[model samples]
Target chain A: MTQALVNGLTLGAVYALVALGYSMVYGILGMINFAHGEIYMLGAFHGILALAFAQHYLANFSPVVCLLGALVLAMLFCGGYGFTLERIAYRPLRHAPVLSPLISAIGMSFLLQNYVMVAQGSGIRGFPMEFGRRLTETRFSAFAGAEFSLLEVFILATSLLCMAGLHLYIYRSKMGKAMRATSQDRRMASLLGVDVDRVISATFIAGSALAAVAGVMVSMYVHAVKFNDGYIMGMKAFTAAVLGGIGNIPGAMLGGVLLGVVENIGIWFLGAGYKDAYSFIVLLLVLIVLPRGILGEQVSDKV
Target chain B: MNITWRGFSGFVFVAALAFAAACGPKGGAGAIRLGVAGPMTGDQAAFGEEVLYGASLAAEEWNERGGVLGKRIKIVKRDDQAKPDQATQAAYELVSEGVAGVIGHFNSGCTIPASEVYHQNNVPMLTPSATNPDITDRKYANIFRVCGRDDDQGRTAAEYAVKTLKVKKVAVLHDRTPYGAGLTDQFKRNIEKSLGAKAIVYYDGFDDKEKFFDPYLQEIKKKDPDLLYFGGIYHQAGPLTVKARELGLRAAVMFGDGVINEQYIESAKEAAEGAYVTFGPDPEKIPAAKGFLEKYRKTYQKPAGAYSIYAYEAANILLASIARAKGTDGKAVSEEIRRSPHESSIGTIRFDGKGDIQGSYYVMWQVRNGKFAALQ
Candidate 1:
C-alpha cells in the first residue's frame, strides 16, 4: 500500500504536468487542445535528441547536467510547437463556430501524430539507460515492504519545483496577470488594453513546457517512446483536467494526483488490465455526480 | 442508381475477379514476383524491413542459382502499416498485380484479414511472423505461416512452468490483442489440464497502452504466485518485468515469443536477467545458418531481427515448391510444399495437412547476461 502511494505520486506528477496543459488551454480558449498530448510526445523526442546531442558533442558533461539540459531543450522546443499549433490550428478557427475549433483540435492531433510516426518510423525508440544510471541503480527503502529510489525522488522533486515555479509566475508576474484577465473575459481584457493573442499564446507555451518536463521524466522512467504513446497519455491527462475541474489550475493538479492514485489502487485491487478503465470511470462519475468537476465547480474564474 | 445487396456484391466481386484475371501472372519467362507485405512505414517497420531483406536475399540467391524455372524472382513490396484494413487493401493490390505468392505481414491481426483476400484470389500467402493459431486454424489452403502457432509456444511455456520449474499458483496476464490473448488462452487451457482450475490465482488482460504496473505487481505479490506468465509483446513485457522486480515480486517471470526481442533487455536492464521467454531455437547460433547470416550481414550491414531468418526460410521454401511443382500454380505449389521435406537454414521444413509446420520448435529461453540463452 505504501509502495502504491510512491508509485501513484510519481505517476500523478507526470499526469499533473500534462493535465496543467489541458486545464490552462481550456480555461483560456474554451478549447480542449486535443493535440496537447502530441506536444508531450514531441517533448520526449526532443529530449531524446537533445540527450544524443549532449552525449555526442559534450561528452564530459555530468548525467545531471545532461538530463537538465535535455529537459530545458525539450521544454523550449515543445513551447515553440505549442505556439505554432495555436497559430496554425487554433487561432484561425477562433472566430468560427465552437464546433470548428474542436474538430480542428482533433484533426491537429491526428496530423501531429502522423507527422511523428512518418518522421520517426512508428517504432518504439529506446532511450539509452546510461543517463541517471546511479539514480536508478541506487535504492533506499521507505518502509518495510516499500522501496524508494533516487530517480523517483528526482521525478517528484522536479515536478514539485515546476509546480512551484508556475504558481509564482502566475500569481506574481505581470504577463500572468494579463493571462488570467484574458482567460476570464477575452473581449473585456482586449478592451482593457490586454493583448489577447499574446496571452493565449503564452498560456499554450507554458502548458506545453510543463508537459515537456513530464514527457522527459516519463521517457527517463520508461526508457522508450513511440508515435501513438501521446494519444492515451493525452486522454488520461484530459480526464485528470476534467476531473479536477477543466478550468481550475490547482484542481487539475489535485485531479491528476487523485486520478493516478485511483488508477493504481484500481490495478492493485482489480487487476492491471483495467488501469485505463479506472480513469474513464472517474471521468463518468465526475460527469454524472459532480459535473463541473471536484475543483472546477467550487472554484471559478481564478484559473 | 438501382441496387440490391446481392447484386452489388456480385458486381463488385465480378469486377474484382475480372481485374484479377486481366492482371494475373502471365505465363512468361521474365520474373516470379512475390508480394512482400508488412508495416514498412509505421511502428513495426523494423520487422517489415527484416521481412523485405530476408525475402530479397532469398530472391537474389535463387536468381544466381539460375532462377526458379528459368525466371528470376522479383519482390513486390507493400506497407500494411500494421492495420487490418490496410492489409486487406494490400492483399487486393497484390492480387491485382498478379504475384505468385505473398511472404509477409508481421502482425497476426493484419495477416488474418489479408489471408481472406489471398484465399479468395487463389494467391498463396506465407507469413513469416504472425503466430496466432487462428491464422492456420481457419484451414485456408492458400495461407501458411513459418513461425510456430501461439498454442504451440504457449503449451511449451505451460509445460515448462509445471514440469521443469515445478511452479504452482501461476498468474497469467495478456494485453488483449489477438496474439497476446490467444497465447494466454492456450497457456490457461494447458495449465488447467496439468494443474486443475485453482492453479491460476489470477487471469486478466490490460490495455497495451498502459505504462504503470506497480499496483498490479503489488496485488499480484499478495497472491504469491510462483510464476507470472505474460502473454504480450516485448514492449509491455519489458516494463512488467522491471516493475515486478522493483516491487520485489519474486515470482519467476515468463513470456511468449513476442518478448524475445533485444528491446526487452534494453528496457528491463538487469531485471531481464533470469526472465524466461519461449521461442524456437536461435537461428543465429545454429551452424546451418552461418552462410545465410554472413550474407545477411554483408547485404544489410545490421544484425538480423527475430523474424528475418524465418522470412528467408519461408521465401526459400516457397520458391523451391514452385520449382518442384514446375509452375507458379497455387494449388500445385501448395501441395508440393506439403509434400516435400525442404532443407533450409532454420532446419528441414515439413508442412502438416493444415499447412502448419510439423512438430514443435519452442523451448524455454532465459535472459542471461543481458542475452537470451536457451535453457539446457
Candidate 2:
C-alpha cells in the first residue's frame, strides 16, 4: 500500500510538472497548449544527446557536471523551442477565430512529433545508464518495509523544488504579477503599460522549462523515450489541468497527484487494463460534480 | 450552364480513362509478379522489413538460378500500416496486379480479414508470422501460415511451466491485442487443465500502451506466483519484467513467440537474464539456413530477425509452387502448394487440409547472455 502511494507520487510529480505548462498556458491564453508534451519530449531528446556528447567528448569531466550540463541544455533548448512555437504558430492566429489557434496547437503537436520521429527513428531510444540504472539500483527504505528507489527520490525532490520555485516566482516576482494581470485582461494590462506579448512569451518559456525538467525526469525513470509518447502524456496532463479545474495552477498539481493515486488505486481493484481510463474518469466526475474544479472558480475569472 | 456541364462531363470521361491507365497493373510480360504485403511503414515496420528482406533474398537467389520457369520473379511490396482496412486494400491491389501469390500480412488481426480478399480473388497467401488459432480455423483453401498457432505455443509454454519449471502458482497477463489475448486465454486454459485451478492464481489483460506496470506487479507480488506468463510482444513484456524484478518479485517470466525481438533484451537488460519464451524452430540452427543467415548479416549489417527465416521458407514455397504449376493461376499454384513437399530452409513444407504446415514444431528458448539461446 505504501509502495503504491510512493509510485503514484513519483508518476504524479512528472504529470504535475507537465500539467503546470498546460495550466499556465490556458490561464493566460484561454486555450490549451497541446504541444507542451512535445516540448517535454524534445527536452528528453536534448538531455540524451547532451549526455551522449559529454560521455564521448568530455571523458575527463566529472559525472555530476556532465549531468547538470545535460539538464541545463535540455531546459534551454525546450525554452527556445517553446518561444519559437508561440511566435510562429500561436501569435499570428491570436486575433483569429478561437478554434483556429486550438487547431494550430494540435497541428504543432503533430509537427513536432513527426519531426522527432524522422530525426530520431521511431524506435525506442534509451537514456545513458550513467544515471538511470545507477539511480534505479539505489533504494531508500523509510517505512515498515516500504522501499523507494533513488530515481523516485530524485524525481520527487526535484519536482518539489521546481514546483516550489515556480510557486514563489508566480506569487512574489514582478514578472509573474504582470503575467497574472495580462491573463486577467490583456487590453487593460496593455493600457496600464504592461508588455502583454512579453508576458505571454515569458509564460511559455517558464512552462516549457518545467515541462523539459519533467521530460528528463520521466525518461530517466522509464529508462527510455519514444516519438509518439507526447500525445498520450500531453492528453493526460491536459486531463490533470481539467480535473483540477483548467487554468488553475495549484489545481493542476493537485489534480496530477490525485489522478496518479486514483489511477494506481483503481488498478489495484479493477486491474491494469483500465490504467489510462482512470484519469478521464476523474475528469468526468469533476466536470459533472465540481464544474469549476477544486480550485478553479477561485481564479477562473482572474486568470 | 448547360454548355459548361456538357464540357465538364467530357473532361470527366477523359480524366477517368487517364486515371485508370495510371492505376492499372504495371507488371511486365516477362515478370512473374509476387506481392509482399505487411506493415512496410508504421510501428510494426521492423517486423515487416524482416519479411521483405528474407523474401527479397529468396527472390534474388531464384532469379539468379534461371528465374521461376523462365520468367523473372518481381516482388511487389505494399505497406499495410498494420491496419486491417489497409491490408485488405493491399491484397486487392496485389491481386489486380496479376501477382502469383503473396507472402505476408504479418498480424493475425490483419491476416484474418485480408484473407477474405485473397480468398475472393483466388490469390494464394503464405503468412510468415500471424499465429492466431482462428486464422487456420477459417479453412481458407488459399491461406497458409509458416508459423505455429497461439494454441500450439500456449500449450507448449504451459506444459513447460507446469512440468519443467515446477511452478505451483501461475499468473497470466496479456496486452489485449488479438495475439496477446488469444495466447493468454490458451495459456490460462492449459494451465487450469494441466495443473488444476489452484495453479492459476491470477489472469488478466492490459492495454498495449500502458507504460507503468507497478500496480499489476504489486498485485502479482501479493499473489506470490512462482511463474508469470506474459502473452504480449516484446515492448510491454520487456518493461513489465524489468519492473517486476525491480519490485523484488522473484517469479520467473515466461512468454510466447512475440518476445523474440532484440528490443526485448534492450528494454529489460539484466532483468531479462532468465526469461523463457516459446517459438517456432530457431532459424540459425536449421542446417539449410546457414548460407542465408551469413549472407543476411553481410547484406543488412545486422543479425537475421526472428521471422526472417520463416519468411524465406514462405517465399520459397510460393516461388516453387508457381514453378511447378507453370502458371500464375492462383488455384493451380495453391493446388501445387498442397500436393508436393518443397525442400526449404525450415525443412520439407507441405500444407494440410486447413492450409497449415504439416510438420511444424515449437521449441523453447531462454535469454542467455543477453540473447536467446535454444533450450533443450
Instruction: Point out where model 2 deviates above 4 Å.
Output: A57-65, A140-146, A299-303, B1-32, B65-72, B81-100
- TM-score per prediction, in order, is 0.86, 0.91
lDDT of 2 by residue, B1-376 (tens): 9999999999999999888777653445568988999877655667888899989988988989979888888999988977778988888888888888999989887898889999998999999999998888989888999888888888899888888998999988898878889998988999999878888988888877777776677678878999999988776777788778877789999998878888788777888999999987777777788998999999889988998888888998989888889898899999998888788877877778998887647889999999998896
Any residue pairs clashing in model 1, and if so which? A122-B43, A273-B206
lDDT of each: 0.86, 0.85
Q: Model 1: per-residue lDDT, tens digit, A175-272? A: 98997888788899999999999999999999999999999889878767888889888988998999999988898899899988888777766767
Binned by DockQ into CAPRI classes (incorrect, acceptable, medium, high), candidate 1 is acceptable
Write the residue-wise lDDT of candidate 2 on A40-89 in tens digits: 99999899889889889998987767877888899999999999999999
Give the per-residue lDDT digits (tens) of candidate 1, residues B30-130: 67888899988654567788889999999999989988998878889999987789999999999988899999788887898999999998888889888
Cα lDDT for residue B108, model 1? 83
Q: Highest TM-score: give the candidate number.
A: 2
**Fnat for model 2?**
0.26
Scored by TM against the true chain B, the candidates give: 0.88, 0.90
